[model samples]
Target chain A: MTKNKNNILSTENLAIGYAQKKQQKVIASGINFAIKKGTLNAVIGKNGIGKSTLLRTLSKVQKPLEGTLFINKKNSNAYQHLELAKTISLVLTERVPESQLTVFELIALGRQPYTNWIDSLSKKDLQKIQWAITATNLETLQNNRCSELSDGQMQRVLIARALSQDTEIIVLDEPTAHLDMHQTITIFELLKQLTKTTKKTIIISTHEINLATKMCDELIVLSENKIYTGTTAALIQQNAFENLFASKIVKFDRALQQFVIHSQTF
Target chain B: MKQKPYLKHFILLSVLLFIFFLLNISQGSVSIPFKDIFTTLIGNTDVKDSWQTIVLDFRLPKAITAIFVGSGLSICGLLMQTLFRNPLAGPFVLGISSGASLGVALLILGSSVFGGFFLTNSISNWSLAIAASLGAFLVLFAVIMAANQLRNTMSILIVGLMFGSLTGAVIAVLAYFSEATQIQQYLFWSFGSLGNLSWSEMRVFGSIYLVGMFACLSVIKPLNSLLLGENYAKSLGINIKKSRIIVLVITSLLTGVITAFSGPIAFIGLAVPHLAKMLFTTSNHKILIPASAIIGGMVLLICDSIAQLPTSEFTIPINAITSLFGAPIVIWLLLRKKKITI
Candidate 1:
């Protein structure tokens, strides 16, 4: 629980959930974790187990039920809205709203928090947008409308948008939700590459536990009414993922080093 | 920046709007020369007295009203569309017009409640605007509340339609209880006209229109961010609740005031934004706002000119011509593009 100066974002005993009808609906609670600089981290859990909730709380999208969140060693609540935006960005799983925006235009919208009143792009913002397009390999699609892109391509566009924000930390919610296997790997690899190249901390809540294990520097596992935060190897050694599911259909296999079907038919 | 081509498109729209302004001003029975119209607009007194009176007092105010109603409603359409992120979102589609209609209907038809004070000529104009705005504001507030409750944008459209029907039912009940002249007064307002605004009314209307338009300008950045979806907009540091309130308030202001002054004109608000989006081929509100405003003004001008063409005893309600001309163009654009994208 020691606060590291290098820790870009950290949470203390965070209770993550939603408020329903003026009552706290605690989906998950008593969670504590910290994310260091320039690391690729993933939050993995069974469906509806509050991985998204925890990520949202950690990113300050939703308020914590009972905890403190710090960014850059400062209480998250102390920073201004735009100041926090410059610190953390998000890649959402929500449907991309219909628009006449081109791939380039869509990504450029990410710089809104940094722009002037009219939202015009500065030279630095323009350069970052270009770099994002090149980084995610969306250069050819820059002129095409976002509506015309395939699901996989749109996911990359979302990442590029987060990149152009130029935040120190980026959080994504199931970026590869609707992609094919190849596209999924491409997204994971792109995320890892982005962290290495830009030195930005990335925390994605994903269902691809195996892919996360293979690519991420750390994993935050939400399961068994407990929160486990550590490197993949360390979590594996500690059996952090044994109770990820209620029915116990899948288990962590030592030989495979990934969650696999323990029974032929469950 | 990929702004050069879009700038050219904006210039082209502006030029077309200017030409249509001349064409519209040159219409009507006396048929003033385009040159005389220009001179009259420039404050030159050399023009004939009759021409000056007709141009300045009648056609000029009507033309300005046409431009205001057209551009104002279309801007409201763009705001609603972006706020809800639904292509079908517009003042009329979302029942904001119905709200205004119900307000005006209540004022005109249900004036018995206020002992016919609402029908007084001297005070009716201001009263009508206030009533329309209040109605538009209430309906808008309800619609926004409903939209906020629902996460799915399409459901917001459905809620808007439901509100439209609800207001229609209320107006019908008011009509059933009213005298014939009251019904006619309400009917006249409902038919929609761009030619009835007086100079005094326009002075007030113009100021309100400018206020709403400037409010629209102030929110362009937030509207641009909203195109990606609200959660992402929030992440981009947009105060979603504040922007939502601003958009809804201006929408109600423009929609209510335009409906009050011009009698609930339709189609311009719904069709012009699509036309602008297609012409500019981008969704940046910075361009779409101006593009839609100009195109809305031009389209309404063309519709107004067409309405004046018969020149006989028979008169065409502007509401009819707008839909007759506008609906087909939107359909053709959708079919030609083979998509219904915003």
Candidate 2:
């Protein structure tokens, strides 16, 4: 693969997995991909297929079992921990620990990497937090405690927090995992708009392949013991969605660009 | 406008704490008048010598201890609850107190089995403090190691509980082998006392508590990030392992020192942080840390005042007073809120 100057993140022969003492479990290997700047991308795979693991590795929260990852034309390993935080922010699916933090306070936490040792927000930090809240449409709920928000609203708060981080790249793990159909679509649209307006690369691992394929500029499909990375339409032409779920009951309809029931047995 | 309620609560609590501090010093065993107490505090020779001695030497040190123990344990509790992300977590939940208790127990009880030299010779308070700190540090080291090895918070909690029970069993065995006098001494130590601290001990305790408070201040940012979860905290550039170690060290120092001096005073560490969170209505540690410390100090002052039994010459054990008062508030808060969060 050619190294594109526009690429914000890329992996070469990457192997992602967990390693214990004298034992290694390779979840996926020989992976190669590049994510360009200002693009919305999605990693879609079946349940328990290492989508989260892949995201964790890319965000540098976990170490890749093998191979190299490059961010902004430099080896990812060379970036200091604080520098990496400024380059890539992440939103995970884990429940926020029980907190009475208001939406504003929670979003301001995103400015942590930029804040001084005391973690006080300056005028510039406050402006960034306000922008994140406004962008995520959380203006009205700024004072409400995080515990009181709906799952969809909470997800947005998490996104706003990532926005406050003000990183060049934002990665989310199943950002819409527990949302309704409408909320999920809204989140996808929000992510797309964020990428376009902020010119920040946004990558999300999601199970909503149909929506992702429709909205995302790029799709990374994990299937058939391999990784497929390309434009959504190009991946569709390559029939990358065919083996997403190796089951007879559900099938990906290339024509309709959605999944359909193969049989009326149910 | 957004910070109005928090500021109001802080002012209210601070005023209450001041009143409680005055009440705590004024109505001790001899029941000195508030005016006399004030005069004594400001270096006025008009106050009676006995009143001055009681106020300056006895009641003052006890009140100061109350403040240190209250603030230190509450902040430590807040740190633990956030680190474990469990509502039930507290300063003692990680067995730091148990470790301290074990140390005290060994000194008091083990002397019987080992020829009674240390106890008969009158072991110094410094030795006891050092032993308790060492025990607490050992447990803290073990917990940190387990935390690094296992990512599960619940497992770490269980491991801590196991260490507590294990220490408890050792204490029990020591009790079994000890004479009744040694057992009585050990029992008295277990009862917890805030008034026994000398002015010199208070200075040492105060400085250590200050160090722990400073540590708490340094980690407030990371602690706030942790409210979202470890993954989110890590994404925010928090070194989770480092934060965990710092929290443990601070907690151990606070709990160990307090327990060494006061014999594992309970309830304040477990209850004060929740009270602060409820009153402030925010989990931002910038507010919660100081708020919890103030409230904790106030609560302990109230408890200490009641334990003094102002009207009567007889006083009650502070541990009993704290449990009786604090346990109910915790229960009421839990029931009223119907949910508890870190």
Candidate 3:
């Protein structure tokens, strides 16, 4: 149960799962982690290891099954939905349901918290949206409908939406899902650049251990028994990732800092 | 955003709506001249008494009713499309019209249940309207309750459809046991109308239409947010439950009130929003709401004009004209675009 003053977001004994028939279906429990400001963090784990659950819980999309979540050293529950929205934003795995929206309009929607009731974008709102479009390198595609864009371009639109929100923390779930290697590496590099340039904290849940270890400043690896949070070098030194796979399929190579097929497989 | 293209389209549509308004009033059974309509529309007594009565008492209200029904149902359709995130959704998708139908069916065909003596001779239009409203609200209430219990918004769409089916089944049962005269009366109600409204009914219909329009305008921000999907909408601080209810209630209110006054007029609500989407090539509800309203009124006015069949005594039912004529035009527009999307 840690709530450090310097951390932008932290958890205290958090438990996460859906409530089925009034019974808590706990997927992960006794979880604890804190993210500092302007840092790029990756929550990496095996399939169904509750990476999305942790991100969703932290973004306040769902209530924690137990314990507390703090945003800026304050109890998260004390913040209003709109207030919290001004502090944190999300890019989720769900596709934009309506495909007819233009790229500019879609990104402009991120200013929902700041726009007036009629949702007309003010000068400041337009500037932020333009900045996000430029940041995501989507200026050429701003006029195109989202349905017309490729998956990689669409992913950037989603990120632009979060960027336009101008929040201190951006949480992305599978930001590179369904994307090619070049696109995945581009997204990872973009996120790193964003955190460095804008001083915004970014947390992403991903299966790309190589990219996580290479690009992210910190890693929150979800294991079955407990959660581990540390710098990649520190976690590697602690051997915190040795049992993450719990499988014989692939082994983590210390020198390469990536997982590779064992030579004995033949 | 530079909305120049649609701004031009709006202006053009507004001008066309005005022409259609005049055209709708002139082409009815009496065939008044455009000058007399202009005169009668303003405070002029120079027109003949017969022309004045036909234009003022008959054609004017019917034309106004056409505009209200068209715009109201179209707005309802727009809201439904955004709410459900399904292009096929329309004003009656939630079955509120069927609820209205069941109410009329129970009143006209439910003689077995309500004792024919009291309601048989004196089923005033007011009572009929009241019954339709009650039936619509009953379904509306049920849908709202169901929406609250269900976490998924798409599930609410299913719940609304289920309510439609449930009420539809009841109406079918009533039609099954009813006499030919009663069934025919209910059938006439279903065919829909625009010319039968009195001034008092217009006042009631117009007020409810305005209220629904205002509520629809109020939800523009949330509606825009909703285009991304619910999770993104929630992240943007939209109260999902509140926005959902407001959308449902406004859609129900507009759809129900229109059905109450004019019967279950179909096709326009479903087709007009698509027309707006096609014309504008944009999904921003800020433009969509008003554009649908204008195009809705224009389409219905045109259809109403065709139904009246200038220089003929026989009149076609508005519903037959709406689908018979409107469908091909929408299909043509879609075909020309070589694509379709909400």
Q: Interface root-mean-square deviation for each candidate?
A: 1.6, 2.3, 1.5
**Cα-based RMSD of the predictions, in order?**
2.6, 1.9, 1.5
Ten-residue segment with the worst summed lDDT in candidate 3 chain A?
Answer: A1-10
Ranking by lDDT: 3, 2, 1
Tens-place lDDT per residue, model 1, B1-342, is 235367677778789888888788877877678788899999999999999999989988998898999999999998888877777778777788898888888788777545656664543666777788788878888988886787665676788899999999999988888888878888877889888678899998999999999989889998888888878888999888778778877887888788878878877877888888877777888888988899888889989888887355455889999999889989988989856555
Ranking of predictions according to TM-score: 3, 2, 1
Instruction: Output the lDDT of residue A123, model 1.
Output: 92
Better of 2 and 3 by DockQ: 3
Give residue B167's lDDT in candidate 1 (0 to 100): 96
Stronger candidate by DockQ (1 vs 3): 3
lDDT tens digits by residue: candidate 2, A1-266 = 53888998999989999998899999999999999999999999998889999999999999999999999989999988799999999998888877777888888889999889988778899899899999999999998888889999999999998998999999999999989999999999999999999999999999888888889999999986778999877987888888889987889887787888878776
For all candidates, the clash counts are: 0, 0, 0
Per-residue lDDT over B1-342 for candidate 2, one digit per residue giving the tens place of the 0 to 100 score: 124356777788889998999888887667678888898898898888988888899989989899988988899899889888887888998898889888888888888877745655576778878778777878888887887887766787898899999999999999999999989988887878888678888888888888889888898888888888888888888988888878878888889889988888888888899998877667778888999899999899999888888688888888999999889878888788856678
Give the DockQ of candidate 1: 0.65
DockQ of each: 0.65, 0.64, 0.72
**Which candidate leads in lDDT?**
3
Cα deviation of B259, candidate 2, in Å = 1.0
Off by over 4 Å in 1: A246-249, B1-4, B33-35, B112-127, B137-163, B310-313
Deviation from native of the Cα of residue B21 in model 1, angstroms = 1.6
